[model samples]
Target: MSNRNIQLAVLDMAGTTVADGGLVLRAFDIAATAAGIETEGPERDRARRYVLDTMGQSKIAVFRALLGDEDRAQQGNLAFEAAYDALIDEVGVTPIPGAAQAIDALRTAGVKVTLTTGFSRGTQDRLLNALGWNDIADLTLAPSQAGRGRPYPDMVLTALLRLRIDAVDQVAVLGDTTSDIGSGLAAGARIVAGTLTGAHDKDQLRAAGATHVLPSVGEFAELILASRI
Candidate 1:
């Protein structure tokens, strides 16, 4: 025990846990294709950049930013989920090395674990079942269930409330995107950790207010046991 006094770890899906193999971007492309949106021009490139920039944000938010309307954004979100589901069906869920083990180790330490993601409930459930992780986490939340997603602190706040953990400082929020860092910081978590295995680079994570940066989510247990993260 490193005496970190942490009680819970709020994790992100996709790049943070599941091995992000450009599948998300490809899914976005598929959705765009389904929606018959711009694909081969400066406009498409800019949208893709925005998607990367806003990783860990609500899919609806990303689509709204990219598509610029509620109806169109909702359509894009549905299409994205459909395409991502298809991808998962074809290839299956691939966990990041040590992600499941890390979660189990944290649970063994008596730390409650919750997963918070921008992915909707259906998609989240699909991934969880594929990983056989449906029973691993103490809580599973999606933006559609929570008020908002990452970079807003809503997900973290919801977890704290639902878990009945009064002290924000007793929690660790870990992910691989700036939105994750921002949300953790906003929620006043003691450890806002960013892993390099995902979307944002170290500099971007730092710029977004990550208190600690690790090589991957796998190192979280070690870092925490060392009183680092």
Candidate 2:
């Protein structure tokens, strides 16, 4: 049976847990430029829309959609990954204010905290290594291991199974993208929340099935705590 209290929190990486300074988008732009996708033409416009629209999805998948071929998509992803790596190396990544506190609070409350992301494990490892957060969460998963990425239940469900969390309804799925909410809802999690910090707006998140939309992940623990009280 499902518990009224949230027992698991499966969080997204980029905009939800860590503040990437919108570098992901900038990296995509670099990939676009590198892939010859364009920057000032009609094709460029379409590519831009696609990148923005596909936020929270696998980077390779997004490139696949934009480039329209597997090989080209891989090329684009490689360029994007390189750009993101360079950006992070130049400017370090920091947790959203109180993000680490929130994670700590959740774990203190006996709720398993796991991170799931659209980045391949290699990129994910690079970022986590930079942040020195490799062992911070209970578990970290990438789509490459989960079989599918965001807006899909695979990663969330995989996390649950790995954590031995039995009741899906006791899970809280929170992120900064609609795809996160979609995955949560599809996985039958009890609490699905969104943050306004990322690629999505309030209306877009609500339309995508978020139970609550907050300003940032910093308030996440407070939100859950308030619910328990």
Candidate 3:
């Protein structure tokens, strides 16, 4: 039996379990251009850097920070979703190698998994449908489904409540971004692991409060199972 007593697992979507192949930047370029940011200038360059820096945050929140106008942010978010969906049709998306097996392992061990994303619910559903993952998770949450997105702890806490998990400490969180680490830490999860299959690096994940750094989500089931010994 696992001694960690983790009854719930909260995982990030894009860049963590889902490999989107840098489509985020491509979509962002399209959205930013539509939002009046020039294609090749310093302004667009700075915005792109910001996008990379805040990879796991809510898309609308990121756009709000970048554009600074609620209206423009809304427009940019819509444009981003449209472009990303189009790209998904063009290129498709895939799961990180072994991520499905890892998730299945965790669930078979009695851990209820909830997939969370910073994207809007519309985009999240589209991604899930594309990957045929609509039924994979015990629950899936977007910022709209919860109160807020990562770096805020709302989604994790919401999962705790929705899943009827008894305590926050019985939860395990995993992601590839600092924002994911921050959300897990803020929610007081017992195991806040950062995987290398996504945005941030080891140092950044540790700095953001990851309890453990993993090579990939493929190792997550082992980490949880090994806690028994």
Q: Specify the highest-lDDT model's number.
A: 3
Q: Is candidate 2 or candidate 3 better by TM-score?
A: 3
| Candidate 3 Cα misplacement greater than 4 A, ranges | 1-4
Tens-digit per-residue lDDT, 92-141, candidate 1: 77988999899998888778899988888999999999889999899999
Evaluated at residue 59, the lDDT of candidate 3 is 97
Top candidate on TM-score is 3
Where does model 2 exceed 4 Å of error?
A: none
Q: Tens-digit lDDT track for model 3 on 70-107?
A: 99999999999999999999999999999899999988
Candidate 1 Cα RMSD after full superposition onto the native fold (Å):
2.4
Residue-pair clashes per candidate: 0, 0, 0
Q: Candidate 2's C-alpha lDDT? A: 0.86
Full ranking by lDDT: 3, 1, 2
Task: Give residue 21's error in model 1 in angstroms.
Answer: 1.0
Which residue pairs come into collision in candidate 3? Answer: none
